[model samples]
Target: VHHGNGTEEILGSDSRFLFISSHTRGQAFYPGTGAESWKNVLNVPLSLGFSADDFLREWSEAGVPGRIAAFQPQLIILSAGFDAHRDDPALGGRLETEDFLRLTEHMVSLAWGIESCHGRLLSVLEGGYDTSVPTPHRQRGGALQRSVEAHLKGLVSSSRLPSNFTSSVLGKRKKPQCGSIASV
Candidate 1:
């Protein structure tokens, strides 16, 4: 899969933004820059056939979640890329749809943990394969759609989740109430 090479490059020198990238590793993959972590950048490069458990472990054992907590960023920006999905033709990053939901739940809690964030999180649509044709709504594979739905479902159920998960990803301005998908 194509890694966040450009974003990392753009923000590499800027300490104001911490660059944490997780991607499939090795030369066979595209844009192999994030093979190592140094300075303000934390690269959680994964080997081929990385399973759901391995993918989730990046936030823990790989030291990403702690780093984010220590940093306590004011604004949390997420590049929601679902290309690692098993259904995707990308590299062997085998994360299922439910994994995205679980990750999003944790991310929502993590973002709210930063007192300054105040549920202000931005999730940009980054990557998801299967758009073989330019059809209506870019109808990605079920994994991407379900993963996104699962991700949004986590956001919607945020109020019930831990750490005051009133994330702005709920698509609201007048309090973090659940809204329609169009808002997202």
Candidate 2:
């Protein structure tokens, strides 16, 4: 139940209230932000890896209800990111897009508990440098684009699935958990 747009007009009567945003400062990517304020901001200009667990923990502490709670949200719009993927060249986030799916599922579960926002969630594209790098390997930005596309496709499929999907995927594979400061 979060929308990132800075415009008060978009929210109608609900404008200026309950809306939150966390985005890069300048127009480093597409959909430039004219926003002047943000309720929750993780403002790291270029690269700052936002780990899934970190997001969950911070959000949980933000006083909002857990991911699975019955709340009435007009709509929950997520600003999806693929640059955080471990493979992306633009960012050093190192987050697997699956983490994004898990987060999405978490929000969706919360919505399901509430009769108001059950199916009213809306997701909007924000920033992802994975799609437009300039190089030979980035022919038409195909290499990273394809990988991100695959990752996003996987995320979509996973979102439709149950939360056990995350447990199952992580259960089969084991990888070191590293925390790095640089975004890339």
Candidate 3:
């Protein structure tokens, strides 16, 4: 996680930050020095091979629900950048659209029951370059509506109710044996 001001704001704290980002490691990319900030800030930059599970593990260890039990955030603004997708010609990452949705889902889950809490969310486009030549996957006029729809549908289908979640900060819940409903 590459913690920064925006991430600090997103997590609603200057401390105990979790900002997951991917950038060229000190290469001659425009507006460089992405990795340099990693060590200096509250960021916990995982090396290569830090997949989504690793992120979840770190997030969990950061005392997620315990932290959220108080100081719940009202909104989540996504600084979305599709350039991380594998089909993007500019970046080297292999992140599929599903990866974005999964990450988005995780963040959304952090804001669960926002309606009851009177909260809202907004998403904005921050970075990405339009390829002059039209790629087969990329529609003309830079329309990724199809991909967005697929990602949104995947998000809905992939989401689970809170009670259905077996994971806890402590550990997984133990399941009862078959035909043992009455044992409770």
Candidate 4:
């Protein structure tokens, strides 16, 4: 919902840590400090309620990929914020659960290309406010849960054989089984 102003403040100037953030800016967004890129911090601000295609385009065409490749850091950490989900009311980000999986897959592939980041990836759950109360029948969880599962699936997809794609991801994936899911 907000920008990583603290992270940028501490490590933004450090050449060892390259921070690339795609967040909503130039509007009534929170913090209001990441409107421009500086030093190691590459801020790609977009309009409020940005679509999935627009977000992906910023990574694909907006020089993010190029910058990441040029840096070639030893480790890659995804501050996996699910507030961007369409169902999330916090940040007007419109992205499906599948989109998170696809993005994770792409990131994993990108990491694979970097010899320093040879699968040394850490996905830390950051922001997600799917505050909608679920009904009795809809006890199967909300978009945040789905997004986390998709992200986890993406993380594990690389190790799984290509032939077991469909069967491997079947059945219910609980939060505790993967990691702790802090509820808002």
Candidate 5:
């Protein structure tokens, strides 16, 4: 989710793909892009200490689900970056492990809504470099393990959830007015 500029640069404006990213926004951040001026890229830039609630709100405001529905992507590629987790010191964003699950669930629901998607989702881990020495309460690998496990479990749970469940959750929401794009 952090610094998806390269992907956006590659696919942005090419209606065949819809590029969406949620990341820290500031001139100080690395690869300082994802600004509001970027066209064809749905960038949800947030300040430091952004929590899961903030993330979800931003996602909804950005009309992510409607964008997905409009695009009707045949497949979804998630550049999963866990460095945004509060425990990870590499990035300043304060997302917790459970936040990842919620985000995954939203994406899964979006995938389920589109006929072409058919739940075709691929998650490729990108960041998270908190692997260091161990402590009494927590270990170097523990956070990574927990985050990965949570993501996997969330995906499984999302897949098992009834289609009606997704409809029930998303049905009340109004359709976004954003334009559609071609399939990736």
Candidate 6:
């Protein structure tokens, strides 16, 4: 989950939209948003050194999936952000690569469960800037590459539903045009 403040601000009062963000809080981070009081938004703000366990617990306890199910959104847009990874200096979130996988899997399952979603999902890359130095820089390039690879793999792997199910659900959509980007 990304710090989707603008999204929340735009769609907060709209019942059809459920905006959720998991990000670091109280440290005067960039953009400085994602407060808990926003309407129709679920903001899980973590302290420095927050781990995956804390994230999982907050996700489960917040009932994010259940909230989405109740909202029954016809489309799901994911702003996948990886700056929360421990190796990322920008936001020191301490999340492992596998945590991103699990997060993606959960979103995939949630989208699948909604009849209106019809496997209609769009993923926009939002964050994850590795600001570490270049000279002995194992953390910047290597970690960014590995994190991106893992995130893509998780998305691809989770999107592979049974062919029959995919055909039946997605047949109603318009044919894909060249150069158009969409996620299943």
Instruction: Give TM per candidate.
Output: 0.80, 0.51, 0.49, 0.80, 0.78, 0.76
Q: Residue 123 in candidate 5 has what lDDT?
A: 90
Root-mean-square deviation (CA) per prediction: 4.3, 10.2, 11.3, 6.1, 9.4, 5.2
> lDDT tens digits, residues 7-108, model 1?
988998998888888778776578766787777888887777677688777657878877887776888888888887887777457888888878777778
lDDT (tens digit, per residue) of candidate 4 on 34-125: 77787688888877888778888876776887788788888998888888888887756888888898888888777766766665679899
What are the runs in model 6 whose C-alpha is more than 4 Å off? 131-140, 158-184
- Alpha carbon lDDT at 19, candidate 6: 85
- Give Cα distance to truth, residue 67, candidate 2, Å: 11
Considering TM-score, which of the candidate structures 2 and 4 is the better prediction for this target?
Answer: 4
Task: State the displacement of the C-alpha of residue 76, model 4, in Å, after optimal TM-score superposition.
Answer: 0.6
In candidate 4, which residue ranges exceed 4 Å CA deviation? 131-135, 159-184
* Candidate 1 ranges beyond 4 A from true positions: 132-141, 159-179, 182-184
lDDT per residue as tens, model 5, 1-184: 3668888878987978888888887765687778763445788887777888888888788887887788888999898888777878666677777778777787777777688887778998877767545577654454555566567666667354555654654577533221221111
Tell me the number of clashing residue pairs for each predicted model. 0, 2, 0, 0, 0, 0
| CA-lDDT, candidates in order | 0.72, 0.48, 0.45, 0.74, 0.72, 0.70
> Which portions of model 5 show Cα errors greater than 4 Å?
37-39, 132-140, 158-160, 163-184
Off by over 4 Å in 3: 1-24, 34-71, 113-119, 130-147, 150-184
Over 68-169, each residue of candidate 2 has an lDDT whose tens digit, in order, gives 233346676655545556567655454665676566666656654565554445665654555655687745453345444443443344345445544554
Best by lDDT: 4
Steric clash pairs (candidate 2): 1-76, 92-183
By TM-score, who's the top model here? 4
**Superposed model 2: Cα runs more than 4 Å off:** 1-17, 22-47, 66-71, 132-184
